[model samples]
Target chain A: MIQFTNISKSFDEVKAVRNVSLSIDEGQLFGFIGPDGAGKTTLFRMLNSLLIADEGSIELFGLDPHKDYKKVRQIIGYMPGKFSLYYDLSIEENLNFFATVFGTTIEENYHLIEDIYKQIEPFKKRHAGKLSGGMKQKLALCCALIHKPKLLLLDEPTTGVDAVSRREFWDMLKSLKSKGITIVVSTPYMDEAGMCDSVALMQNGQIHAVESPKAIVDNFQKELLAVKCNDMYKALLTLRNYENCYNVYPFGEYLHYIDKRDSKPIEDINDCLLKHDLQEIEINPVKPDIEDCFIELTRKLSV
Target chain B: MENEQVIIVRDLVKKFGDFTANAGLNFHVDKGEIFGFLGANGAGKTTAMRILCGLSSPTSGLVEVAGYNVKTHAEEVKKRIGYMSQKFSLFEDLTIWENMRFFSTVYGMNKTAFKERGEMLLRKLELFEKRNRLVSTLSLGWKQKLAFTVAILHEPSIVFLDEPTGGVDPITRRQFWEMIYEAADNGITVFVTTHYMDEAEYCNRVTIMVDGRIDALDTPAKLKEKYQVNSMNDVFLALAR
Candidate 1:
């Protein structure tokens, strides 16, 4: 369990996290989703006690992350976004060092990280820097779990990893969650938003929305449409500049647009396209996904 | 020509001294497809990519990237292919426009080519106004977009991007993929890697690597079907477990 009350963090003149307050439940996969400089990492460091917040309080497992940094370190496992593991040490050696630092051994919590360990086991003798992106992730996860902390804090754990390893790593977290461990994973990937039990969509160091991924999507107030035309670029410009459009953004092959007139007649779309000289047009009402929710939320908040 | 493979690797093995980073890897990326190369951390994906980019050598393997043999025609391959490294390594001292210009010159683009492509990319990325700003002053998401634009300055046959959207917001990432798709539509093969499964869904084909070998390779739909999971993330967890 974790709690932050009116927490504000700043680096010199810039405020990273501003007046933030939230709670993360036990045995949950909590995600902090935002763009870079949104203050997710700053919040992570404060919660982990690497950096002290300028104002407010952070409590982890009933202990303050700042004042009780030492004890918090004992009960919480943290994997920083940037590769913070010992690069010079071999995979086994890095794991050993982290375990020793946490006053434990790999064998003690081997079961917690076993799924990840197996992949990096063959390279137990390979230097940490020498390992590939996926292996490094496995090693970091294994090391984090060595102490069997009740809370795990991972900052963008899947950033540069390949898709498969990214998937496998999340699965490892899921299994760990089943064992009743409170996991906190931060990522810029909005799609990963669905995987968490709850998420806080952070922007500009403030909490925008916090809820289950599905709940966020359900909360989307606009009716969405996926549209494609002969020239998507030209079409996007046409759509964005279209009259009374709430939101018009490109999503792969189609432009996911929301109109102020959600229930507008289909004939109106053709009439609008005809005016713009846009041909090969198709529009279908579509369900809003996490990204759509993210964009919609940010747009409304900014307005 | 429509279905021609852009990057073809067979029995690809890459060993750095005693460590075999990539082991007997085999895969093909078709022309104009956005292929997602995936793996867990330490999963040999980067190793295989570096070899195909001609940045590193394969101990023993048969490989072709844009029709050039990686070993014998590395320079030619380098010319025809673009790469965006995982770590954004833009020149901080240079202005955004200057950086693009420098890279264009490095790729041997003529003045006409530079002006034509430069304006096109800047407009496409919405970086036109800030082109005069130093690279260091740009936001992370903007820098990422610019870095990607620079990679394809020469309009390489294939663009290999390694986690090009790290630490950016989801909205920017969505926009970034759209650019990649547009590039693919123009007959430029895209070989990209990412830790996000949703991004993987955008790829024509995806390869998931575990422990220096590919554990699965297929479209996101096929992969989901193969692993009996509704999502690619779940599929990875199943294989990893």
Candidate 2:
């Protein structure tokens, strides 16, 4: 449905988005996961024709985003990360305005956003600024979808809302995809990465990994262990100072340790703990999460 | 008493006219726990956070943060709490050091103490080299890290980070979490609200808020298992469904 060939964008000397080429299929929820300033927004803006790429080709449904922006805009729904709706307008008014922009009426596209709209309908008369962050988000989603574009580009939709709201918003997106709307979303949330059909893990204006979340996790080439001890702080100190420790860092309640290239497996970890006289020892292989993979990838890049 | 929580709010309520943003909310955070406050849009997380940080007044309900009542002793709460807002909460035009100093002064830290703390915090975030640089000049991730540092510069007993990692890189997000651990190790209670479920996994415990109400609150593992989902996002979806 979408194709980009050697898309490279720059703002003066800084290359906000490096030459990137990838193809996205139709009826798919594609996740672009990266930190701020990694050019996620820049790339999205380019796709929507809000900004022109310095060097590259963007084909949306086989039409150029730059040349066919008007036709492209009609087929795409964009929910910006920043609250872009008129803050003074009521929720209904924003929806109506956006619907009118695409030469449609709220009555016409009301069914598309009805699920999300009903949640905020009680506050329909309230000013957007008066709504909570989560409410504003839903309203934005409703307004964006009012036109019912074939492609939806949401920039960090769950960035500021609460956990439940974040969950609810994704639910709405999944429902949208069920209606066969091809969705593209950019988020910094690693947990959200696994929900998508495919994801492109990006860093420093470059893609670190791009594949299904499961495939990426399944491709982990290193053995991982979760180690808990009497003094986790001391254990971390001991582990980081250990001779064969590859990556030793605390993860929530336990410290996650990966052995060096040539280090032994479970026995070696147990032996190290026994030698340190650490109590309540628990050394077991564990699956690495997207965050773990992300941290590992970033560390590799830094090195 | 030693196991007692640092923040305890019962029936926490906030209203804007007839609208009740937070109604009858009850939650607490352990002395040094990284508590995740999850909620959808309009779920009252921000309102509750505002009251906790002394930024806004709760219309009703008993609210306690770091042992301070939100209503009667907001100043005391402010003195002991640090806050990072959802947006560009820092001064866009000011230098990083200036912004930190200004926040220090607002928090009533004296010159000597502010100087020592400011330098230390800046160094911890590796922003010392960019201390004199304008806030606008720094990348979004760098600015957020600096903001998180400034929030805790007073060494407050509790810190509230409201979507502090939004729009930043994954590496920076990991680094931000690292700083949170360092703070927790130093005995500072972290109260945060983020849309990232993976981040929710980092919290000692997480509470899910939907439509101004808490739907689920527990360890990420329990929540994931209960929902029969592999990720926090799915856990949230399962509960919401």
Against the true structure, whose DockQ is highest? Answer: 2
lDDT per residue for candidate 1 within B38-117, as digits (tens), equals: 76666787788888889898899899998999989999999998888758559989998999989988899999989988
Question: Candidate 1 chain A: minimum summed lDDT over ten consecutive residues — where?
Answer: A262-271
Residues A173-200 of candidate 2 have per-residue lDDT tens digits of 8999999999999987777887899998
What is every candidate's C-alpha DockQ against the true complex, given to 2 decimals? 0.37, 0.43
TM-score for chain B of each model, two decimals: 0.95, 0.93
Off by over 4 Å in 2: A87-96, A104-148, A229-234, A262-264, A271-279, B1-30, B39-51, B54-74, B205-241
Tens-digit lDDT string for candidate 2 (B101-155): 8998998899999988788877867778879999988877777788888888899
Cα miss at B49, model 2 (Å)?
Answer: 4.0
Give each model a TM-score. 0.79, 0.83
lDDT over C-alpha atoms for residue B234 of model 2? 77
Against the unseen true structure, what C-alpha lDDT does each candidate score? 0.83, 0.83
